[model samples]
Target: MTTPQALVLGIVQALTEFLPVSSSAHLVIMQDYLGFKNPLLLFDVILHAATLGALLVYFRKDIGKIILSLVRLKEKSDEEMLNRKIFYFILVGTIPTLALGLVLNQWIKAMFTSVTFTSLMLLVTGALLWISKRRADSERGIEEMKTTDAFLIGIMQGVAIIPGISRSGATMSTGLLRGIKKELAFRYSFLLSIPAIIGALGLQLREALLEQTLPSHPFPWIGGVLAAAIIGYISLVLFRKIILRKKLHIFAYYCWTIGTISLIIRLAT
Candidate 1:
């Protein structure tokens, strides 16, 4: 990809990744519109790595606490105990997500090829988000979260592997329906994504290496990564504010509008 194309893809990936919109769907749509025959696997991996870095940087304090709590196992403080439990909760959540991803990997890849299917899924995502908006506000925080809640949320995350099904939307909606506070739902949804993204990055890297699809000059793509990281951090911050403000339902309309238009265009063409 040229520098301009890389930058465009980077911006799309960054914004959609955290905006309760499907990044994979947007990338597929962008590539189709740009007439790219195949995705640049190496470039895609790099973009994801950049967003993963952004997640780490944004949640560094929480991650640090988790790490410290694990290392100093003897600490019986409530905060340490909470951090340690959260670490276990993440692991539990990852289980169903990884399993579903593995089982549906091939099917999900096929889904990426059909814009009609993706557009339809976008409608589904919108409905899910709208449902989340109707849920009465609850005060359940991470300290009150249970393993069942994590597992259920993870199942939704796994299902969101399909194009147009937003992972953040699915997981966060699940958290909300389970009565988790909006802030914790938002925070936990992204936190759970850490393992999912890492697993995906690992698989994509292996595929890129085996296919020898690495760009002849990767330096140009570095700009894409930087753009993604910067925009991704900002997106995360903005999304947090939106969710907290109970305006997440607004995206439902955006998704529905886009989905309807895209579906019509795909059908007409």
Candidate 2:
């Protein structure tokens, strides 16, 4: 891929990585429709690592507080409970995706080659979003959730390992339906993202090394990584605001419309 192409894909990866939309779907669609060659899995690693860094940098203060609070001699009941539960929830959410990514990585890639599957998965993603939008208490905060709710949301995060499944949409919807507030749901979804994203990328990176699929004209990753991280950070903030304003149903409509169109295009092609 060209430098310009790499930059554009980096932006897309950053944005879709956080948004309710499916990043894998958009990447596949762009690669197919635009004739963009694969930039190798290494480039993908750089992009995700950059965004991971972005999340770390942007949330550094909150992350520090959370970490410190965990080790402190004394903490409030509610704060302590929420922190402990979220720590476990992150662990639980990472387990299935990491295991599945390692074991089923090839099978998942084969599915990616099938445009029909991508489109179908997008359709499934949209359906999920719409279902939650209709039934979920769009007003609940994550702080209001129970331990079971976190685990249940964790399961949905596991399912998002498939290309078309929307990780944020799935977890947030699960949280919402469980009566967690929108901002709280979004935070959990994104926070859960930290572990899941890193684990999946690491697995994929390992597979790429074994397969020796590294591209020759590798993008240095500095620019693409920075772009993704910067954009990802901004996206995280914007998405939180959007959720707080109770505008996620707009994303519900977006997922449905785009997924439907993509499916139709696949069937027609």
Candidate 3:
């Protein structure tokens, strides 16, 4: 991709990745408009790694607390215990996500190149966000989370493997619908994605290595990664504040509008 295109794609990825909108869908659309005949899978991996870095930086305090709690296994303070429970819940949530990702691997790859499929899935994401808004206020926190809740959220994350199904949207919406507290649900959704993104990056790297298709000139993509990582941190902070206000459903309108326009344009052409 050209430098300009790379920068634009990075910006789009950063914005959409945090919003309830689907980052994959926006990437596919941007790639198509930028005249990429094939999916930039390797470039995508690099960009994802950048966003993952943003997540790590943004949530470092929470993550550190969890790790510290786990290490001092002797500590029985309520806060430390809650953090430990959250750590286990994240592991439980990753299981179904891994299973679904493996099962849908091929289909997921194909969907990346299909604007029609992505557009349709975007509408589904809209529905999920809208429905989540209707759920009554909940006060449950990490201590109240059950294995079943984690499993169900994992299933939602797995389904989000489809292009245009926002991972954050699906997982967060699932948590909200399950009556989890808003802040906990938001934190858990992104924390759970830590494992999922790592697994995806690893798999993609292995595929590139085995196929001997690694990009020889990766410097062009580095600009994109930097853009994604910087803007992604800002997006994460903005999204968290929005989530706290219980305004996530507002994104559903944007998703619906974009999805419909994409379908109409693609069909007419």
**Candidate 3 regions off by >4 Å?**
209-219
- Model 1: per-residue Cα lDDT over 1-269, one tens digit each: 78888889999999999998788888888888878877666777889999999999999999999999999999999999989888998999999999999999989877877789998999999999999877748679878899999999999999999999999999998998999999889878898999899999999899877766667887668878999999999999999999999888789998898889889998999
Task: State in Å the error of residue 260, model 2.
Answer: 3.2
Q: Look at candidate 3 and give me any clashing residue pairs.
A: none
Best by lDDT: 3
Which 10-residue window in model 1 sums to the lowest lDDT?
A: 211-220
My TM-score estimates for the predictions, one after another, are 0.96, 0.87, 0.96
Residue 137 lDDT, candidate 2, scale 0-100: 53
lDDT of 3 by residue, 48-89 (tens): 889999999999999999999999999999999999998999
What TM-score, to 2 decimals, does candidate 3 have? Answer: 0.96
Off by over 4 Å in 1: none
lDDT of 2 by residue, 189-249 (tens): 7777887777777776887677555566556455667778889899988988877776666
For TM-score, candidate 2 versus 3, the one ahead is 3
> How accurate locally is residue 4 in candidate 2, as Cα lDDT from 0 to 100?
73
Candidate 1 at residue 248, lDDT?
82
TM-score of 2: 0.87
